[model samples]
Target: MNPSASKIQNPETTVPKTPQMNERDFINDQLTTEKYMTNSYNIALNEASNQALYQDLATIFKETQDCQRNLYNLMFKNGWYAVEQAEQTKVQQTYQQFTGYKSQLPYSVQ
Candidate 1:
């Protein structure tokens, strides 16, 4: 086997050769790629629709969160009210003990 032929067959020893290509084909492919890619992909979406959808979703989420907060507030408020009521009841009992309801002398004294 010839050493020169063996060297040509080896990729490491061989020089890289440029292939012949058509300029028109290259330009066409570049133009096609540019046409497919756009600056804003979501430009097709309507502004009105986007706004309405976002508002609707935001309203639903806000309502759900507000409902949870209101429930917590109501629960705490009721607990506080119960405590206040119990304190008032204790005060009332003490007052009743001091100024006990009188039978007076009874109907016979009247």
Candidate 2:
């Protein structure tokens, strides 16, 4: 099979090449910022000492995550984001590999 056959992408929306930033550049920058914020919020959430602070961070984290998702969706809709379709065999192999390690876990998964 052709390697590119599994690529799942829409026709790219073109943007004019210019010194100034375009719509794609602006959105991409915001997306990058959102991603960084989410990561920071995640770390803060993990090490939060106070219950109230934790809750506040959690809310903010969720909002940031939602915003990130929205940005991702917008980029995808505009054909700025492209994802590759995973091969079924490779997916199944990964699944089986992980499943085989279940017995090594301290707690039961089921």
Candidate 3:
């Protein structure tokens, strides 16, 4: 007759079963989580009003970014991930494209 007891003993409520996870699965999950964390930190960093908070978030963001990069390197070394190298010409073109925007800035170098 108790409401709490009924809720606790509800037959429709079910817990999710844990799936089998391996090393690659764990690394992939960790890498994905860290990437999300860095993205969230970036948004928070942009919206932070206090300088101290901004600096703290910036440091944490950098650390998370480094950790994510390290995980990527590990996966790459283990052949778990395949990363293609950019051609030198493509790299040079991209560099030139970005550098072309320097003249669009409002500030002029004296």
Candidate 4:
């Protein structure tokens, strides 16, 4: 781990390590499924030609995305998921680097 990067997480809630799947394992599996569903839905939405089909998929996509976020939150709350806090200087540098590419785009960026 980088010295400047700190973990944003709660204390881990203990889980069983038996042959059977535990709560964390089930949630993690669901979270992974939701992520895959969302990605597939996005691609489908992009290629969908019929308006009705597109609308249906769009709704499902939104729901899947929300579920994915909820699962992530649950995992984070239980310390099953941990995110690294980006150093402000590194974040600023990345922002600047991406922003510098705005001028290279054909259309004007606001």
Candidate 5:
């Protein structure tokens, strides 16, 4: 075996390249992961049998949620995320559709 070829084939001899993530992608990835963690924390809080554990998890969940929100706001401010404003007519139509279905519910609301 050639020495130069062996060096090329050896994984340990090769330099490990770090993943290149753009600012937008980095922030988006962090926000997505935090949102997922927040959801998991919510589930844990709901199933928590110990009050102390529940309180601790609730605090962490709120913090994670806030972090996620902050990331989203930053991205929005930087124009990384585009949000479209809904038309008033479309909003009214959605409201009417839900209200119509609400009347068909089995439980009566006073």
Candidate 6:
């Protein structure tokens, strides 16, 4: 009996399935940064239906020398709880960041 062959036949040991991605979805989620997100947002805005675009450069704009360096620790987390929390906070801060981002930002978004 081959242990490797037996292990390969077991489906229960596999990792959970990630969400499916179609052609457009793949391109849509390509970038994970607010800057690229904003640039993509810009291009998408021209093609999108809404009149104004809501995005910020906070993710890509690291004017601060050590910005987000503290949060990099999430990479060592166990089950992505840290990553999820980081994302939630990032979104909230990004929302708040973008709230005032307009005035401080380089260009107009709305």
TM, every model: 0.24, 0.90, 0.71, 0.93, 0.67, 0.19
- Our model 5 lands, by Cα RMSD against the true structure, at 15.8
- lDDT, each prediction: 0.43, 0.92, 0.77, 0.96, 0.77, 0.39
In model 3, the runs with Cα more than 4 Å from the true position are 1-19, 107-110
**Number of the top-ranking candidate, with TM-score as the measure:** 4
Query: Per-residue lDDT of 3-38 in model 5, one digit per residue for the tens?
Result: 323121212222234677767668889989998999
**Clashing residue pairs in candidate 3 (N, C-alpha, C atoms within 3 angstroms):** none
Candidates' RMSD to native: 36.1, 2.0, 17.2, 1.3, 15.8, 16.9
Off by over 4 Å in 5: 1-19, 97-110
Give the alpha carbon lDDT tens digit for every residue of 1-110 in model 3. 43333221212222234687756678879999999999999999999999999999999999999999998876666666664555667789999997878767767651
lDDT (10s digit) by residue, model 4, range 1-110: 99868989899999999999999999999999999999999999999999999999999999999999999999999999998999999999999998988767878553
**Candidate 1: C-alpha lDDT:** 0.43
**In terms of lDDT, which candidate is strongest?**
4
Error of 6 at 5 (Å): 37
Q: What's the candidate order when arranged by decreasing TM-score? A: 4, 2, 3, 5, 1, 6
- Number of backbone collisions per candidate: 0, 0, 0, 0, 0, 0
By TM-score, how accurate is candidate 5? 0.67
By summed lDDT, which 10 consecutive residues of candidate 1 come out lowest? 6-15
Residues 1-110, candidate 1, lDDT per residue (tens digit)? 32333121212222224474444344345444433432122232223367777576556555545554554344344331122233555679988775554444466745
Name the lDDT of candidate 6.
Answer: 0.39
* lDDT score, candidate 3, position 12: 27
Least well predicted 10-residue stretch by lDDT in candidate 3 = 6-15
TM-score of 6: 0.19
